[model samples]
Target: MELKEYMNFVFPGLILKPSLYYQWDTRIHFELAKGLYQFKSEIDELNDEYFNRVYDQTTTLFNEIFSHNDELFLVTNVYKHKGDIKRNKKIKVYNHYINNKNIRFQLKEETLPYMFDDDDADEYYTSQFSLKCQKQDIRYPVLLKAICNQDFPPLRPRFNNRGISNYPDLFFINIKKNIIFYIYDDRGCEVIASDIEAIRPIYEKYNEWIDEYCREDTEQLFK
Candidate 1:
């Protein structure tokens, strides 16, 4: 079957890349956002009428994304520390998960822009807001919440990383690699295609890694 770009891959938080679950498309529809400006709107408290509309729309989307039979969504929320370059900063983090045990990832050119990159920046978090994402894997999201709440577990999931693999003392499960998906996450799912050739070569590496892992795992199971 002929599959489209967005539909066969990606979930909500992976908007910097390609996807097909357009709002105008058939069956399910969702919108994408980029940069802090767009999220500023999603994060802010809204008035009653507007909040109702947003709440209803998000409620419908939540139900659809969660109840689908086979397709799995890997929604990841990237969190970086906000204050001085001190270690063990408690930053609020949210998570998303993929259920395929064989799928892996490798990050591309960019890194989290807001994270403290050098000794010059503050790594401490403020009480302004806490990050949150629902409908994630039970194990993974719990880990993230612990980080946000207690600042423990000091190992970040690393991939083909060029810069600092992680912030000092702060850890998160890398959305790029070291994650797995399982069959239970694949009930009514159609994994139309695993890799997209048009993607940036870096991200393509991640997808290829996932495809190869899945292939090898399936082979091993049957062998």
Candidate 2:
């Protein structure tokens, strides 16, 4: 089915904010299966049983859809949280039988937002602001790198001063078609399919439909 048709059926009756205001950072929360918890505490604190369970289940889910021919990657943001904590939020990416599992755990400094400044505080603040503004645009390259790395952590963190957060958990790239599928967690497993051509029609149609059905304020947010 066409993307719009799918959205109409899936998103209709459901209340979803427009793509702009929709917080990409929340994807990890939505994707975690029921009863499985991803701790917000330090990674070192994560128990091996919980980690293995999550990993095994996640990998199983991914492997079901993606294969070797299809490139899979994780996408997420690196956020410097309060208390000087650096956390990596995981998201899941799968396409055509190739599951790029736990790709967010493997991200490096170069793949995340970076800042150039003498003042450490200023750099962190600036990077955070920039990341919020340009996250959608920067998402592609990070996902590409994740796929290329075979979903493994790079040697050493990419940089020393900056910390990362809200990293993407999953990405699927159809190399032959040059299409990128960003599968995020929202309410359920929400998939955002973006190809210059494939998604434009859906966006246009969604805009048109919103114009007919949504309030002006709501429309403004969604558009």
Candidate 3:
């Protein structure tokens, strides 16, 4: 499918432009933020225990919400972290993944004038590919795990050498169910659905694991 066709199919009426917040119809959605805690200053190594727990939970949640054998569209938005003089090459994380995995990708060129108006958007692009479910074996889980582990360039623009936001870099779409799951690093993840009732089971099943700040608001959507 063409780039526009894929966007229309997965995102529908949502605007494809940059925004301070998600352009989702929040009336039927919930934003799950990762809970942050103060770290011990003397820690020698970062403990990703929480990250692993969340990732495992998400893996189970995906299997529950989505059919174990369904084909899903995995879309990733790559950012060119310009101004990083340490690395003066066009990013090729996804390219490496494609070549390593031998998968095809549909590419799209886009610009977030708000984020990178000065840089050419052609260098920053989006890739769309087909991914199978857990029944198909490890490909699906491995890719998502790699993204959460920051194996590729993040999905945010750089300004004065810093990232702009903690937005999700990639998302998996279940077109048939009209649902989208977004992974925003170890900090958190989000799941948006067209039908509240359809997602209530998932919400209830995982409510305890939902970010504390978003719990109340998420609960309100069910009422």
Give candidate 2 regions above 4 Å deviation: 1-33, 36-49, 72-172, 175-190, 194-223
- Estimate the lDDT of model 3: 0.50
Runs in model 3 with CA error above 4 Å?
1-3, 15-21, 26-41, 81-138, 151-168
What lDDT is obtained when candidate 2 is compared to the true structure? 0.32
Estimate, for each residue in 1-223, the C-alpha lDDT of model 2 and write its tens digit: 3223433543343222223124331111113233434343555343344434434433433343344445432223333533444343222222211223343333333223332233453334211110111122223433333432332243111122234323433333333333333433311232233233433443343332222222354434334
Backbone clashes in each candidate structure, one number apiece?
A: 20, 24, 0
lDDT of 1 by residue, 15-60 (tens): 2211222211111112211111211355643233432333343333
Q: With candidate 3 superimposed using the best TM-score fit, by how many Å does residue 59's alpha carbon deviate from the native?
A: 1.3
lDDT ranking of the models: 3, 2, 1
Clashes of 3: 0
For residues 1-223, write the lDDT of model 3, one tens digit per residue.
5445755866677533333126664422323224532233478444456445645766776786678555555554534433434333322434434432433333334433323354565434332223333234334465556655562243222112233222325666665676777665545666776667667788777767666666667677777
In angstroms, the error of model 1 at 36 is 23
lDDT of each structure? 0.26, 0.32, 0.50
Better of 1 and 3 by TM-score: 3
TM-score of each candidate structure, all chains considered together:
0.26, 0.29, 0.63
